[model samples]
Target: MRNDEVLVKVEGVSKKFCKSLKRSLWYGAGDISRSVLGLKNPEKLRKDEFWAVKDVSFEVRRGECLGLIGHNGAGKSTLLKMLNGLIRPDEGRIEMKGKVGALIELGAGFNPVLTGRENVYNNGAVLGFSKAEIDRKFDEIVAFAEMEEFIDTPVQNYSSGMKVRLGFAVASQMEPDVLIIDEVLAVGDLGFKIKCFNEIYRLIENAAVILVSHSMPQVAQVCRTGLVLKQGKINFGPGKVSNAIINYFGIFENNGLNIEGNRRGEIRNFKFGNNDTSVELDISKNQNQPEIILENCQNVFFETSVIIEPSVENFSLIISITDIDQKVVAQVTPPERMFTNLTKMMVVEAKVNSLMLNTGNYSISVHIYNKSNAVDRGEILIGIRNILKFTVKKQKFVGAAPILYESRWKEC
Candidate 1:
């Protein structure tokens, strides 16, 4: 790698955690263990040795955003801690090019007993800032944190949001060469999250960023590259943001979505995909529809699979489409939407009169139910299947909302 090309680099890093009871003891390890073991009902000895991270290595260039995604206990947090220099890796080396600002946990660098002002200065110093420099950015930090009135109050009196706000404000001002953030951003209100994203976007223009978030949309929006960690190693990485997400969800399907013993309804199968990339459809923008020739669009169709649960009675299917704002855009009616008194496989179909959506994104929502009241209804209590999302785009804007396609532009 060239000198100016990389801002942060890690070569073959690994971290492990011990689950031993005696290992955690200081001096009287045997005595404590024997005492506990000799009790009337001795506690079971659980095996130790869990590898949180194994041989993980990747480099991040300056002004690049990297997303770290993994299942719970996938070493994402441990890797982040090592990057922040809070913990040392058991193996391999990490090289950083410049100062780092990290928001690993809420209230990480705060002094509970000290006033907010003091904590700000303390955190600034921890980030290697001088008193004068902290003072210069003090007002901006306080304003951004929205804690001016309580600037003199001790941190112990602050709420979680306040703590996160202060921490984010201070870190935002550090202007470090790299920033490492965990999923704590999911806390706080929606507006705060939006503000944080804006600030982080600005920071990414000058610094390398490593974001660990559970929200897939946030990860896709900010990071150009991502690594999907499975068990303890990097399972996928250096891939397109969308592909990384698909791969990450693949882990869940393999593990999280596995059926346990048995539930009310048994799910047969499912499918997921993007209908079109050119349209870029989401809930807020356009319904996920392909460009229609208006005349040829007598029927614009979306596809989804139908699953029948075991012994479900009077079962039926439901399909719906909602805008990016989650408002219902369209839905297949029951007579045209449902399957009755049948098993095996059912195909769901929806027809649209015309596709007049503006160039935007939209989502498709589907549901399955039992029509107990109807005599011909197939009653089966299978769990609701996954949502199907697609995108629709065009060269020009057609209508204000999806359904308002045939409006006039007369100046009369």
Candidate 2:
């Protein structure tokens, strides 16, 4: 086959399931009878039935990878199962060319009673490999999985990580024409995951790859294209991976404020923005977190009023900016000397000369820490997470870095 050949083509594919097992069995029997009588099954959903995947269409060519991403039960697994030929689509056609390898579930193809060594050969044979072919790659698979010691042990006794290691090693080593990997890699240790990704990078150069992961970074790193599923339908992109990730984050936005800290202090009011735009957060009136939208490198400011207990003397205010994944991307803290005076109620203000975050969704976390010394931010008097969210619009450079620094270039 040519390198640019389309290895996987899914056209208007959809799958549905009945909510009740009895209903599902009944539906299955009826469908089977209809098929035997040269009749077509109903395309529309019947009672107690819902679409798991609906009218999804995309094609993957050799030397390309497609990232399928969504929240749990968004039909990602059902779509993958259909692609792997483990299940049939109810409403659409799927065409896959050449050999296909899938690691859809943890230890999916593994035999519980069989030793790791035996299962390796069994999987290889299932992939159309002969005994001698499996023997040639046997040691490499063991080494890659780092399961040399446990190769003779029954798979049923293996840990989750061990099973994942062996399963990935076999699937990847066989070098099938089309490879489908689900989130099973999450079970492996960090070091092993890194090795597996390196192997995947190599594999995608010659094979069509379909990756399903909730980890946006992993999907961005591996897939050239992406598709986001929401409630059994396409929410965004069979296009750029970045946009798909953005849409995926957008789906879960407006999650209300989360606060964690001692009861010594309470935030009365909070607001942030510049002259052109501003957002005030009202916990009483609005249950959803408010969002601030700004262009890259814009100046922004924050102000908050807090009421403290009589026992509170010296304290420092901490502002943290976190990404969609709730990972701290930036933090701001006032100097210790700034809190010299003691007061029961106070208003605090902070300014950012230039906000350099890349285009993405982010949230602010406000923390009031007790300050005893110059170095120690002793303990949290009050901490409010997801106080409000924000988004930095796309700029000239759309790299993955959380913070985008402006740099000047000189050509020699």
lDDT of 2 at 28: 99
Please name the candidate that would achieve the greatest TM-score relative to the true structure: 2
User: Candidate 2, residue 88: CA error in Å?
Assistant: 1.2
| Global lDDT of model 1 | 0.70
Q: lDDT per residue, candidate 2, 1-412, as tens digits?
A: 6889999999999999999999999999999999999999997789999999999999999999999999999999999999988899999899999888899999898999999999999999998889999999999999998999999999999999999999999989988999999998998999999999999999998999999998988998899999999999999879999888888988986655577888688888888888778988865465666567887445689898887777877777989999877789998768657473356558899988887888888888999877746667778888888888887787566777998887899999
lDDT of 1 at 243: 71
- lDDT against the true structure, per candidate, is 0.70, 0.88
Error (Å) of candidate 2 at residue 279 is 4.7
Clashing pairs in 2: none
The superposed Cα distance between candidate 2 and the true structure at residue 315, in angstroms, equals 2.9
Off by over 4 Å in 2: 1-3, 262-264, 274-284, 287-293, 296-300, 338-345, 353-356, 370-381, 393-395, 404-412
TM-score of 2: 0.87
